[model samples]
Target chain A: MSRSTRIMMSVIYWAFVVYVFVPLILMIMMGFKDSKFIGFPIKSWTFDWYLAVFSDTEVLTVFGYSTAIALLSTVVSLFVGTWIAVLLADRKFFGRAVMFGLMVLPALVPGIISAIAFRIYARVLGIEPGMFAIIWSHAVHNVPFVCLVVMARLSTLPKSQREAAQDLGADPLVTFVRITLPYLRPALIGASVFCMLLSFDDFVRSFFLGGYQPTLPVLIFAKLRSGMSPEINAISTVVLILTAFLGIWAERSMRRMKKET
Target chain B: MTSDAPTQGAAAGTAAAAGPRSLWSSLARSQPYQKFVDVLFASQRRSFLILLLPPIIWVLSQHLGPIVQMVSVSFTDAYPRPPGQEAKFTFDNYLLFFREPVYMMPFMRTLIYAVVLTFTTLIIVYPVAYFLARHVKRENRMALLLLLLIPFWVGEIVRTFAIMILLGNTGAVNLILKSLGLIDRPIPFMYTGFSVSVGIIYLTALYMLMPLYSALEKIPASYTEAAADLGAGAWTRFRRVTLPLTYEGIGSGATLVFLISTGYYGTPVLLGGPNTTVFAETIAGFFHVAGDKWPTGAAFACIMFLASLALTGAFLSGMNRLSKGGRK
Candidate 1:
């Protein structure tokens, strides 16, 4: 590459990076501003808003509620997704193509469309809008990701391992528990964290289905509607720190596990 | 089967003589339980069914079932009909969309915005993806990509709030411009089409970047080097070789960005003015009102869904044809 072209590319790359981080940095900065308003030229700073996030009962409850829902949905999706992946991993199967399409259809549908559909379906089933309804929608939404991830991991498994287990008189269930499950540990952990983050960050579904209590994103939406506040920024900063940490951890561990195997 | 019956009878007799130590333990050790376990794994077909049944039921009931229900609701006269009323079928719900310019305009605007924004995101993100995948050292690429992705991990509402902070009257943009003497007064950037577009591009750019980066990364260095040896200019080399090779990535990235942009409810609501209302807000407006209008919302949602799917299908096929032609 020419020197001028290389310089141009580097400049563009750094500009994009600045564009990505400027808003985020401003958000974090606004969180520490002492005044009620959100703006530049902060004459004072304080930690009161960040402290308020922990001391406020309502915010704390919403955090616990969102975490509970994320955990429940993640566990359910992992179970269903792993089952489907195992079934589809066979070399030749009838209707495999059709089944795979069906598996992926949910993830392709837009969030609003699916959320509306689930709202209607929940009413039809006499399931009132509440925690159960939210969990059901989140798990269904997350299953495809889990299935895809687990299936990718399963594809790399050596066939002879299973055959060897069978040669030693292990039953199908035993062999699966001892051999297949162990092999899928890294993928399962990765998919679980991904699902948790997805479910926790989900807004449309939770907003549509939630009743009296709101999840974290829905609560943030409510706060936004009232108007922007330093408290909202503090809450956002905390969430950003948390999810970034979890995501980085998952990526590093998955890469390390892949190398080990 | 016949032999198992006698064994089961003996086990029951033995349990009776054991003074009822524990009914659960006795039953677990019984012949019938063993037989059931044996039958489950007796054939590969049986095991396959055991694995396949749950996902099939789940997909049918949870995934496809709700969508099918939505379609049915869209055709109905009313939903949540008062206690005992039957659901009468009608096309009026869908007809409402075609007749009202208020509804139709936003729907059209949504399609246009989605296409334009998807293209814009592709243009803005392509060079950066190229830089990372082709120019940067492979060892540093992953760390840089992760840094870029951290902002996306936060929820939509939080990120939208960030945009609101950046564009408000007293926001960073206005403050900086004022300080620099570029303007004496703050510019109103919030609640505009520009704001909404910027927010959507910010949110959906990652979708485009991932696919394009992977596609660019997969291109062999030899092809570009060979083109260089043949004395092709930089622009010609890119147009003929790199762009054609990344068509699959472009197609996928465009599809994801388009679909996501079309379905956005929160960002548009937060950043857009009344004039810039998108189709998702229009559909959501119906659900926010009386229950009687929910059918109308379902119908509108279905229209958006089918239209987006059709456009993407066409775009993908066009990309496929172009890629094939380029190869020839």
Candidate 2:
């Protein structure tokens, strides 16, 4: 890079950094404003909105619901996803391409269409819509992603490892527990984190699944619907920080895996 | 056309060698030291099926079903019927949409909006993505990438509404400008196409950055280094080497942005003025608010679904084609 080009890139980069941070800074500033609607440009600061945001049961529960659903979806999807990867790796199966396509289907579909299908599907099954169904939908949506990432790891595993384990008197169960699971730890964790973040950050799937209860993103969407308010800003501030931390965690894990390979 | 298929022959070979016991029994076995090998192989197939069935079923119904239904809806009169007519399927909806000024104009508007948003986001995200990919040190690289993507992790509604606050008439933007005597009254920033585009850009720009950044990062340092060693200019190397290498990322990013922006609702609804009706909002209006005419909304949705499917296919095949990374 030449000095002039380097200077130009640096200037543009800093400007972009400003573009990224300023809205958020304004959001935080607006959060402390003594106002109900997000009017922007603070006259004076107050923590009343923050208090209202935390103290309001309805607002707080949405956050709680999203967190719970995200966690459960992550764990359940990880298990199912891992199982699929194991099967995919160890077996040659009929209609594998079809299965892989089906697995990634939900993501490829538009949200509005998916929402209607869920609405109908839940009705025909006579299953009530709520947290359980919401979690199920999220898990189903994310598992294929988990499978794809983990399958990358699974394919690279030397056949010798499994064969060696079996020859040394280790049963399939023992070999999987002792060798496969440990070896797959990084990809598994990567898949898990990615799935969790996805579940939490999602809006569309949750909208369909949410009936009596609203997930965090849906709740935020609802709030955005009527009008913009300062309370939403405070909420975004917290989310931005948490997700940033999670992204860092993912980046490190990926780098570590790359080095090992 | 799709992913690599699993072959049954592989299963047969593994099964013949692994031996057999019940997969469930392997789980319940007291001694996990090495004994339960046969059972693990026995249930692996079934467990994998069980694992994938729920989500696939969900997608088929939730995804594929709606698309089919939506296309069907596009044909019906939906709510207002012709004299002596019943709720029947016809090409009228498509014809009406194309012919009627009200619906036809908005569709064009929506298309322009999508195209503009795509190019604008691409232009804006490129340098930031570039810096993260090539210029940032490895140790600091991850941190910078996180910095770019962190806004997205917060969730779209929150981020969109945050912009609403900042750009609101009495919002911080005006407040700051006023405090600094840069303006006399709050600017009419909210509920306009500008505000809507800004919000959409913020929400979807992250999609562009991450993929482009991933592509950029994958370019070996040696390519540029060797170019520099040969006295090639920075711009020359970037145009010749870096850009070509990241075509997959570019394709994916553009596809993602295009798909996401087309289906967009939140930003446009919150920030778009009365004249700012998007195709998505029209779909929402057709079903939810427009007399419960599920069919018409379904039709509009089907168009979107079809467009996205085509776009996604184009993107993937393009990625596959460019997978050689311009080496050839």
Candidate 3:
């Protein structure tokens, strides 16, 4: 709290902001660069890279595929993960701790290891790895995030409304449908957006599981491996902007919900 | 049937007495589905079990099942089978991991880098997280945190790619330094442990910051005031009150950073030179580049997984002890 300490703290704070934004700014600038090489001192500006990204059929197809998978996986995770989260929040069963650990275990495990497992599982099941496998992998990986958010929201909910509903002879299902589910709306929205972003941005799992039909990140990684291009920069910038927008929106809504609560 | 009717009538009467137009009462009016709902839910335990069963089964079978499969695969000779030959279970894959210094060195190096990255991120992120928690206005806090997190939402590969652009020989960093007469030569920042660490720290900084910020924010102001009233100096109050309260945050943050850094593949591969091989890249190589070496890959991954599990256990137990000590 000393003057020097205060000055030093503010400097550190701004330094972090600069550290985070500088690279991002460079990336955005690269997207606009006419040259393929990403470097300082822009020689010219062009929208050709952006246009190329849109014109390329493979990139467009992969983008569409990634979007579809992300949406489906998010929806699936929200449905199933909400149930698990609610159960964890509502109950104190004997195996509760174990259940919680198991729920979060997938998220904790390294994605490459999961990818390896998924690859083996696919081979064993005689199921060819494709969009289905990738979607399933993403949904499973994302369940923990949904569960965490929903559980946090559930903990904040007062027990009285739920108890009162049950006290009036409402079944647990009805109480959940009418009372508890509504209470979890903001958390559900926030968590689903988060899960969607995670699934969309996931690379390693998609790389292994996306055998024939690669997701956007898988394609991007593959493209980058070959070498960098302004086109890749364009696609990355688009993805970045989309995710950042969703993230900020989710945070805003969650903050608003917090204030209301 | 007669007893059921009487009970139903009593329930309706009680519901009506409570409030006929209430949300619960409205739901209760759906009498036709009530029996079906009761049969399905029956008990809280039954309902919870029914609800939990699907996701649990999916996670276990689809997610954990693969990991379990990896462990089994590592035990078997998953590659180099002759025509009409059955692969047998053996410890050869794991043995290779320990015997080969190429594998063992990277594993050790990964742990070292993970520790270094965790501590580096902790040191850099702590002050910022503290400032945001203690100084930022309530309305601005969430927005600022969101800004910090926005870069992370861009994906790790993209972020690392950006870092590569920033630190490449002809990158902005070098160009700026050169223009400022800071250096005559472009620093080879792209292919080094320094770059790898910087990239990893940048990618995972928010993970550390958010937890630390929340933990610091949760510290009640009254405790600090009480320390001040006791004639404690700023440094003394911070060391005793602030540090202990936020120690949990540091533990969680460091654990997260370490876990992610150890498992991370892209940063080390893209930015790091030959000397900076990480455990994940090695695993990736085994699976991707080395033909018919998946068993070895599985074994290496299993070793890494076990280490991660141990780290998690230590952190959790330490956390438990910390919470217990705090109570006293």
Separately for all candidates shown, the number of backbone clashes (residues 3 or more apart, or on different chains) is: 0, 12, 0
Specify the poorest-scoring 10-residue window by lDDT in model 2 chain B: B33-42
Q: Which of candidates 1 and 3 is the stronger one according to DockQ?
A: 1
Predictions in order: lDDT = 0.90, 0.72, 0.83
Checking candidate 3 for backbone clashes, the offending pairs are: none
Residue-level lDDT tens digits of model 3 in B225-301: 99999999999998788887887888888877877778777668778889888888889888776446888888889
RMSD of each candidate relative to the true structure: 6.7, 8.6, 5.3
Residues A6-72, candidate 2, lDDT per residue (tens digit)? 7677677778877777777777777788866566445688887778778889888787888899899
Docking quality tier of model 2: acceptable
DockQ of 2: 0.42
DockQ of each candidate relative to the true complex: 0.63, 0.42, 0.62
Ranking by TM-score: 1, 3, 2
**How much is the lDDT of residue B129 in candidate 2?**
81
Question: On residues B235-273, what C-alpha lDDT tens digit does candidate 1 reach at each position?
Answer: 888999999999999999999999988988888999999
lDDT score for residue A254 of model 1: 71
Residue A239 lDDT, candidate 1, scale 0-100: 90
What would the TM-scores of all predictions be?
A: 0.93, 0.81, 0.90
TM-score (0 to 1) of chain B for each candidate:
0.89, 0.76, 0.83
Give the Å error, residue B43, model 1. Answer: 1.2
Shift in Å, residue B92, candidate 2: 5.5
Query: Which is the leading candidate under TM-score?
Result: 1
